[model samples]
Target: MRFRFVERNRGFFGRVAVAVAGAVKASVAAIGVLALSASPAAAGPTPDYGIDFAIIGDPGNRHVNFDEGRRFYPPYAHEGFTVGTVNYKYRMSRTEITVGQWLEFVNAYRPYYDGPTNAGQFTSDWIVYDNSLGRYRAISGSENFAANMGWRFAARFCNWLHNGKVMEQWAFENGAYDTSTFGRDDNGNYTDQPVRHADAKFWIPNLDEWIKAMHWDPNKNDGEGGYWRYPTSSDEAPISGPPGTGETNAGTWNFYDVGSYPHTTSPWGLLDGSGGRSEHLETLASSSGVRLTNGSDWGGLVSFDEIDRTASELPISSRSGLRLGSIVPSPPAFVALLVVGAVVAQARRR
Candidate 1:
């Protein structure tokens, strides 16, 4: 079920006379960024299941803290690691996967659920199975709350979306990712794949995608660009409070509904990137079991607003939510790039 990502090059540049191949590569890379920035991809229409996304552009952009000097509270060694460089364009969910959206997935996938028990499938506190209804439902007012179903279930959710929300066993197992690799090896090391297949339609955002969504601002540094210290496009930490009262929900005791702070957004327009629920990223913290998570939860400290901070969690840990990433629309990578060029031209003319 593994697929290779096909790299496509447009011959629009005709020919290059560079002596070094590396120079040609650099030149093409520059063109890609210029093309994408001049005409950034538009966020696709919301899907039938209702997950809206923010288009992240500016391919081949530089990473944050490239020299690795950035540090924050506690200053874990890995905290200094550089991130945010991504070479392709994709869309990231505007908010963490919400309870209502997960409910739709739960009802669609429940009839085919063959797991030993559904106990670990969701955060019992927010979503629950009703014996009378024979389907899962989000608790009373938690419909818009961020769902905390851990990493593996989140992967399954991606698989479901990749399969177009089909109500079949295979749809919940394979597509964007392979569930067969979900098991551990003889030496007790987890065998789950570290990333999604290249041809996937939708999957969990990797650490780079997550960081770029939360911090990278293309218009920064007088349009030359740079990353922000926080997801709110600001260097200062956000103020915490309930909906409409603060810039973020983190460092506060209560979990407000997703999008409670519509004005508080990442440079790319993603909401709740700093608080609400820590996001489950596909980047692995360790091969044994730990996976990487980004941002702070509703009860996180003020320092969690720092973009460099991250936490490690087991794949089965249900303490975090997730965000999905998808190629512009369908496959054939160059088509998406072409769309970017078309949009860019329109914007420039205006």
Candidate 2:
């Protein structure tokens, strides 16, 4: 009987030990799952060339009333008196295309354009070649400055971005442009009026779209929705200077870095819309087939104070820059949570 009791006790202790070990393993697995679920998933790697965009939502079914004559101090008639409306919502780049981003495009498409030799000339005359660095660099002080390119070049840049940078499929195909939609001469000049595709992934913003994004105020006039006189989210003009300087001047060359003036953002929080580089608009002027440019540049006379619009008859020599616009998808809140849950489950399994 004593031997039998000892064996039974040993068997019971062995079973208890096994149960405890199994419980500990299950607890560890549960803790890992809880940790992953409680925390957000790690963000994906940043793109080599990424443009941060601001999502502009529709403002209670309202339209912008744009009239340069009434809004401007001297009653300028360049943009003309017009009422604008945007039916759908879109996203606009927070800042003009930066030198770094443009450089990536030039390096990717240099072989197709004119090989690596002429890559320096692809950006602008301002970009200088550095012998020591063995690469083209924007002027030392203008690293984050907006790129100065023509309308056609800007369009091609959009196409390059759409074609995934490595492939030259969309805009200029087989060492030539898709002439059925884009009109190009043998000399590589855009001969006809450029028309954007209906379902283009990325393109320049049209006049109405650009104006609305710049000035539309959804919660103005007791929430009835209205437009600001200027793009600075205020009736008064924007004061420009280098980033972090709080000085105001009508003609100060205050071309601050992108999104430097958070207070002077548009109604939808788009930065540098009023002061920086004059952005190219896809809209063509009525009389001339040339495209139009909006906003004020660094060097201009009260251009920052007004909704300035300049028609680009000569796009080649123009100091115009580009701000890309796109239609991006926004996932629902619950869907985002589910995505996180799935990621956590996968991590726990691993």
Candidate 3:
């Protein structure tokens, strides 16, 4: 696969690319980081799935699992969380939540939580859900969880809700659904608002939803199928020498930028899921012993080939950061146009 980054940002992207290669050389893999869960969610739990519907083959194969010695995995980790009101059936919006998407959340609650993860889940003091203020604010969170990393926050919200917990923390704090609404006896005075799903974008992924957004399909069938890390998965740290190394299939590849290999992208054209960070769907494990605390971040997404084989055996925050997971109805037209322009511009220069 080939990717042509814009010229103006080529230098910057180059630095990022180099750093990614360096990190992969050191053998750090961006698995998945999600907040920990403590209970077994309902038997048939469904998370708040949000994203452009991609026709996934088997998304759960790469999802988290538990080792009670019974080997249990959710239908799809995305299926663990849920959104929309009880009466509303949600249809995921295509595309990931972009940087702009989370900013809305950050800005909306500025008066409440003013912390500085950049996504606005905290208050100015950088604390999370500070209770003393009797309002929404950030408390001093050191561990990575929902909110800051973007997509992981989306996944975390779903994980929390799938556990049948207080999924309405944000809305309740903002007074969107107050006591009057809960105890409403006057049907005539109900506000002209439609019942929103919890956090509006949280839900589980059906097989189709997962595959399309991530754009992954593995030929290896390692467990369910080979765990393709992300788009730049194959382009990561170039294999320095002979075979038997984990970075390359033949172990003779070389360093390349994330998503630089566009050919590896899914047929639907999603990039970097195999060689980059593993986007969070939900929890990796409900066991306190094995929980992921952060979402897949940019650093994680660039070097898919560098990961070790124990992928099925590690904890999450032990993973990486998050992305702007979206629920957009379709891949944005602009993305394709942008890629075409990048490719053309690079070729012309040559």
Candidate 4:
């Protein structure tokens, strides 16, 4: 993937201004513009699955397992306390998987449907099985809504994408995760694979990956490293309301359209990390029988969506949403992009 460097102002006001009214459209356009430039692109081209991803490039950054010494009412979980600290680079979807994206996967996989990972269950009632047509369709006006699916189904979606999105049964079984590992052992404990294969190109984000994307800022502390209190890139609590009325369309009674709050974004330019829907992580919760989920749904309270709050649910539960994680493109493309980025930084200083 060839790319040209698009120098962006990393200042606080600069980020806010870029994320105004037409944010989603502008972000997509910016991705395209990066690809058209002569140097290596910072992010890869939008994949065939149509999920645009943001590049998380800070490697070997230290982790912040605690609450930065803030002794809030509820203490931090020091047991699984690690946050950020990824030694390698990766990319995460800018927003949760939408109903339309799920529908396309369902149609392709239906050519050879398996008993499990039902497409109908992937997005609540927004995606329904059309008996007459022998396929699934997205509800009117729900094509862009974030999808909530079972963790297993989300894993299979990653498998399908990793295998080039083929329509065969094998394509959905094993690529990033092994479907055969989706059973419990004789001890009655869940026996799913603990992590994605080393060669995995796409898979569910683990705790580290998800937290880093939502919180880590490479430019913090004179480029040493830092994290935000919330995914909206602000330490302040977001006001609850409809799009264009608040920093985030979260902490409300209903779900807002995905990416509706164009003004909210993480340091890496990811959207809806706090509101929208709580997303599943491959990391297991501290509690047994549930997997960890980061962020909170639209209906959650202000404290529920804070960076310190981590939610979890049963793996079979379809309550959590999906965010696809992927490795950065080939080394040559990434290296070229970085070189160009450095040159641009130097030019800006002059």
Q: Among these predicted structures, which one has the highest TM-score? A: 1
lDDT of 4 by residue, 1-350 (tens): 22232444466434433333234344446555444331122334436467788878767777864554242223544444456677777788999998888888777766665555344455454777778877778778988888888888788898898888877889998988898888776766677787788777788998878878888888877877788888877777777788878766566767667888877888988988877778999988742436888887777765666666777877778878898888776434455445445544554454
Please write out the lDDT profile of model 1 over residues 22-45, one tens digit for every residue.
343544576565445431333233
Give candidate 3 misplaced runs (Cα > 4 Å). 1-53, 57-96, 114-201, 204-264, 274-278, 293-350
Candidate order by decreasing TM-score: 1, 4, 2, 3
* Span of 10 residues, lowest total lDDT, candidate 2: 39-48
lDDT of 2 by residue, 34-53 (tens): 33332121212213246887
- Best model number under lDDT: 1
Model 3: how far residue 145 lies from native, Å: 19
Range of the 10 consecutive residues with the lowest summed lDDT in candidate 4: 37-46
Q: 206, model 4: CA deviation in Å?
A: 0.8
Which segments of model 1 are wrong by more than 4 Å? 1-48, 66-81, 114-120, 330-350
Model 2 accuracy (lDDT, Cα): 0.60
lDDT of each: 0.75, 0.60, 0.32, 0.72
**Alpha-carbon shift of residue 245 in model 1 (angstroms):** 2.1
Error of 3 at 205 (Å): 6.4
RMSD of 2: 12.4
| Model 4 spans with C-alpha error above 4 angstroms | 1-48, 65-80, 111-120, 286-289, 331-350
- Comparing 3 and 4 on lDDT, the stronger one: 4
- Lowest summed lDDT window (length 10), candidate 1: 12-21
